[model samples]
Structures are given as structure tokens and as C-alpha cells.
Target: MKIILISLITLVSLVSCSNNSQVVSPKLDPLNQQFISEDELFRLVLHMDKLDYRSDEKIQLHSTLEYIGTEKKATIWHGMPYINYLITDGKDFSVGGVVSTILKSTTLEKGEVYTFPYIKTGAFSENDPNADFWREFFDEKDLYLPPGRYTLTVYCGFSLTEDVVNSKYNNKVEVEITVD
Candidate 1:
């Protein structure tokens, strides 16, 4: 009995010592909007390494879109890429499943434009929107506001490897934007 108790204690100590540290840091908002503030024509570029594509098909990196129409429209749009979306109620936010995009083997820059196109879930009608904002992905549309200051969050997972399928990565960003 004494030997068994000693062995049990030793096993417990070994288990405690092997914590298997998994450092999950809080997400950092690093949106590179150094030049344009409100209604300026600009583009967005997102980087992806093959592993981030959780889709049934192999995801692609390096894509573009004509999001910024003109300097006065205050319009930016991208097709949904992920499954999480959020709606804001002043201070807090309402979360939902929405459209989001994934990238692999790519880099984002100021001069790049990314476009995502989606049809609104409801039936097509004069009163229907061409696309669903938060219903698809977490973009500006889900926030639902008139014109004010707000913060936008994007969650990205990444992985880079000689065989991208074997690498691992996570990338997310938040942006300070104005409604108009």
C-alpha cells in the first residue's frame, strides 16, 4: 500500500508538471488604414496560407475587389468569408452567423482590393437588399448604424508551410471606421 501511494503521488506530480502550455493571446486589431478616414476610395488586401481554408474546396490567396466606389459614397463591401457576424447596440454587440472570406498563400497591402459577392437570403424584391451583411460574415453591414464612429473586428486563422496543409496560423484585425 505504501509503495502504491508513492507511485500515485509521483504520477500526479508528473502530470501537473506537464501543463502543455497553449498561449492564446488576445486578438490584436491591426487594420492599416493610415490614409483614408471616411469616404475615400481605397482597397483591402488579406493574406492567407493554405491551412486557413476550412472550406470543402481548397481556398485561394491574393484576391481583389472594387469596394470603394468613390470619395463621396462611403461604401465598402466584401462577400462573406466566415461563419461569424456581429450587430452593435451602442456599446455591446449582437453576434450571429454571417458571410466571411478566407485566404491562403497571400499578402495584403494598401493598393489591393478584395471583393465578395452574395445574394441576400430573403426572396428578391424591391424592398430586399442585394446582400445580407452580418447574416453572411462579420462586415460593416451587420453593425447596422446610420452614421457614427464604430470598430470592426475580423477573425482570421492562418498556417504557412512548404506544404501549406501542414502549417498553422491565425490572423485577425479590427478597424476604426466612420459611417459617413
Candidate 2:
């Protein structure tokens, strides 16, 4: 009887230990997705909140630059808007803008990440030339585009050091999304 009790205790202890040793993985966010591009010195990741959106719903877009080089730290010099976007639907209709000529600089350590400013979407005025045509499909505030598939291309332009006149790097990544 003593032997039987000892065996039962050992089995229970083993089961409890096994349960405690199990590792639970983290759940991924469905709304947030990433498209990535990498080079010898940097890894650029483009983040989109969702792949599909309603005609009235707004879209979210952003990007991150990670220092993947073997150096202790790296400096990036660029203009006011270091990141730019070009969105198109494989047709004549496209959306983009120009950035200011003001210069700026940013530093990052090894394995460190730098997040750029968020990309704004759907900010059109009723006085736009195509406002009347787009009004049939989208609301005034959501006049970026109609419901369809689009390819969003992000450009990360910078130089390694303060000498912007010399070498420059332009990292580009693209992500596809659908607007219902």
C-alpha cells in the first residue's frame, strides 16, 4: 500500500510540473500587418492596419527602419519628410505629394528601430477638380480613392552620414490592400 501511494504522488507531481513547463505563445494582431524589405545596413518594414476597408472607413499606414548593421550606431540624414508614399491602382489615377527641402538627421543604435510619421489618407476638399466625380462613390472626408485594390509603395530616402551630397540610399517597399 505504501508503494502504491508513493507511485500516485510521483505521477501527480510529474503531471503538475509538465503543465507548469508549457509555454504559451503570444497571439498575433489581425489588424496590424507588415511588409518588409532589407539591405546590407537597414531593414524597412511597412505596416498597414488592415487589408480591407469600407468606402467610408479610413486607412492606416506607417513604417519602421531598423539598424541591422554591425556598427555600434548609425546616423541617417534626410529632408523634412524622410518617408514618402506613392499609391496607385495600375491605372492613370495615382496619389502622391512633394516633400520640403529642409534637412534633418536621426541616429539609431544597433538592433534599434525608428518609426516614421504616420501616413495620412483621405484628406480631400470639395473644391478639388475630381471632387464631383468622387462624391458618387466616397464621402467628402473619405475622398482618397474609390473601392478597389491598390498598391502602396513607400520610399525611405536617407544618407548614411551628414554628407547628403555624396551617397544616398532609397529603400522602397510595397503592400497591396483592398478598399470596399
Candidate 3:
């Protein structure tokens, strides 16, 4: 009787464990950002937000115009770093998943510039535990504006990223940027 009882208990435990199933989102891990090389070319990256999206297709590309400090934590502390920002189709594809950002920025001594490449793919699941770095940046932002021209204007209107910003976005200067 003891042996039979033990077998029954084990079978019940296995059945209970087998019945558990859940869907979870992946996490957006941060990228290991570094200088790809010395002569890397950088262009201006603009996020598609706060304006008329003149394009019919979704997904716009953008870059962050960051202000650099002499002794900041996230920078080499030489000059301002302009990062490539992307305003993806996240809004229309809410049912879709998170997008990862592999942004890179380098500053030239005489030019005001920033650039990054955007590869818009599926979104990440919060429960996915193994989402990539770019995915983390993608999952953080809840809103993705339509295709249009806009400005950085102080890391989204506040000084949250000021330590990483160089004296550019604070003026709320909206330059003419277009998306297709």
C-alpha cells in the first residue's frame, strides 16, 4: 500500500506541473556601444515625432542630437555625441512586438552631427528574459510618432538625459526633417 500511494502522489505532481503554460515578452538588453573604428562616418539621426507624417508607409528613422560634457558618465568626454534615433512603426503595430536600437554616435570637431542605423523588426516580450540590447531601448518608449520632421529639444523636453546631452537640444529647435 505504501508503494502504491507514493506512485499516485508522484503522478499527481507531474500532471500539475505539466499544466503550467504562459506567454512572456523578451527583455531589451543594452548594446555594447563602442567606436567601431576611427574613420566611421556619422550623419544626423532624427526621431520621427511631433509633426505631420507625410509618408504613407509607417516606420521613420531618427537620431538623437546629444550634448556632451567634459566629465560625463556615458561619454568619452571630448565633445557632444549625436546618436541615431529611430521613430519606428511601433504605434501602428501595438499588437506587434518591441524593437531594438543599435545606435552609434561620433562627433567631428568642426561639424554638428549625429547618426545611427535602424533595423525595425519584431518587438520584445517582457517575459522573454533574453531580449537584445536594442530591444530594451525599443521597449522603453511607449509612443512612436508618425512620419514627419521634428527636433530633439532636450532629450524629450526635459533634462533627464542632460548629462548625456551636449548644449544642443535645450533650445527646442525644430529643424525640417522628412520621413518616407
Give the candidate number with the greatest lDDT. 2
lDDT tens digits, residue span 26-74, model 1: 3323233322222233333332232222223322222222225433332
> Of 2 and 3, which scores higher on TM-score?
2
**TM-score of predicted model 2?**
0.65
Q: Which of 1 and 2 is ahead in TM-score? A: 2
The reply for model 1, stretches above 4 Å from the true place, is 1-90, 95-114, 117-148, 158-168
**Whole-model lDDT values for every prediction:** 0.32, 0.65, 0.32
Candidate 1: worst-modelled 10 consecutive residues by lDDT: 116-125
Prediction-by-prediction clash tally: 24, 0, 29
Candidate 3, residue 17: Cα displacement in angstroms equals 38
**Candidate 1: RMSD to truth:** 19.9
